[model samples]
Target: MQNQWLVAYTSPKTEKKIYGRLLELDIDAFLPLQKVTRQWSDRKKVVEVPLFPNYLFVKITQQERWKVLSQRGVIKFLSHGGVPCSVPENQVRAIKDLICEQEVEIYGSSSLCKGERVVIVKGPLMGFEGFLTEKKGKMRLVVRLSSISQSISIEICESHVEKIYG
Candidate 1:
């Protein structure tokens, strides 16, 4: 009974439904949600939405994938090289760790500005931390993943960033 993470794609806005079904079947699942503050015609509100729309994580055996495959609202697992993709348990664990301890925040701002104090985890850049700065006259936000002395810039906020801070 080895544990594996599979990417489950669902119909638009069906993430919650898929999550519930997985839970009912006693499957472990994860969905990273982002907290956003939005303004409506009459008021402001804080909303939590999926970071990756139409996706959810399910922990199951390869033999059990077909059961989930037939579940309502499910599209299928992601694939590469023409094979179904299986996410690593460690990767899922790390994302869960971030969900537990991350403080990065993102909000609507003036046409793509810089942020401050980003903490990085994972990759050759593991344990990397730095401040974010904008490239001259560009709307893209860059985070100096290392530091000022000798560092490189990586584009964030427009990519698959797990989290952002205030």
Candidate 2:
């Protein structure tokens, strides 16, 4: 394959299951994960967990895509023209870098929901680099700091958040 990454859009919330299945099926797959440690209000506890909830990256030959499609939790490859599309290597590498540096732990769906990058302006959280998400009928701007891999998401009002690059 000319590309190293393919997007595996799995059944919702079945990301981990698919990751394990892919490995079991001997497919070189990676479900990009961010370790997060969240504590309950009355507890001094934390847990490491994944950031992206339902996506995984797979390294497969074009010929082996059918094998991937046969996996139980896999839905379909991200595609165009009815042919599976390869995810850009740099994008996959960026995900790897985030995982390697542990930068992804604090970053959540809201942080990178609008493609891969964004610029932030307005609010007390100004100058904080982050991403946006449209959820529950609102636009959320989130900044995830590595301190706890904890993200602060606020419903964005009238603000200046623009994509610098995608």
Candidate 3:
């Protein structure tokens, strides 16, 4: 059976634990982590924390879906119409890429929910298209992908995009 990338909702603060379990079960799993420094009373330490709190991604086939859900700390697969949905490969890659980025921001669903559809006409992200939303003096290209039911925003220059005809 073919496997597809899917998102799973996990118990609070158990993202890493679930990821490890999947690995033990020979299931392909990914938990994007970001480096953050925390300050204690007398010391500071750098730690890798889950980028998306309480969420984990796994590559599994339909027959293996139930196995993932049965893992401890795993709540359920993010689904629609009672069917588990697979996240687009490109969206998965974007999240993976963002984890290595030194500066990035994750916004709520409302922030980029509406705007004009635009395509990047220049720069490294040339040909990228999404809803363009301007915030805090910065222009962001927000791409909303189904399956995950989440939108990711990438910083872009206002001059690099032009409107697209339907």
Candidate 4:
């Protein structure tokens, strides 16, 4: 079977551990991390945290599924109905690229309102399509990963996007 990208739902707070184990097994895995500032009573510090809590991506063939499941802390692959759902490669690449840029925000799929579908006409994320939303009075282009029900939003100029009409 050809290798495909799959989302793994892991135990709470175990993403980093499972990612390491997957690496040791020579399995390809991706855990998107973001640097955030945390304030303590005494001081403030920056740390890298998982972009999607309790989730990570793995590239594997059908035969390697068992090897991934055998890892501790991994619950199971994200599935719809009874079959595993695979994420599109471009969506994965969009997430990877977006995270590297500043002023990016992550949102749960539940909070987003349905808006006009648009494609970025200009900018580093050109050709990326997502819903346009106004949140807190800022224009945001939201790229959603439907399989995981999560979205990555970034501020964009109105002129940078062109609405898609059916």
Best-performing candidate as measured by TM-score: 4
Q: For each candidate, what is the lDDT?
A: 0.62, 0.62, 0.76, 0.81
Q: TM-score each candidate.
A: 0.64, 0.56, 0.70, 0.79
Candidate 4 residue-wise lDDT, 68-162, digit = tens: 99888989999999788898887777678767766443233443334879888866667878997778865578877686888777776666677
Tens-digit lDDT track for model 1 on 4-102?
Answer: 777888899888878888888888888877677999999999998776688788888878888788989998787776676776555566456545554
Candidate 2 clash figure, as a count: 1
Root-mean-square deviation per candidate:
9.4, 9.9, 5.7, 5.3
Residue range 34-61, candidate 3, lDDT tens digits: 7779999999999998867888999989
Q: Candidate 3 regions off by >4 Å? A: 101-143, 153-166
lDDT tens digits, residues 1-166, model 2? 5435777777887888878888998888877665556678877555534465556778888888888888888888776777766765654554464456411122333434543456656434444566766566455656674322345454444334555563
Q: Kindly report which residue pairs in candidate 3 clash with one another.
A: none
Score residue 77 of candidate 4 by CA lDDT.
94
lDDT at position 157, candidate 2: 45
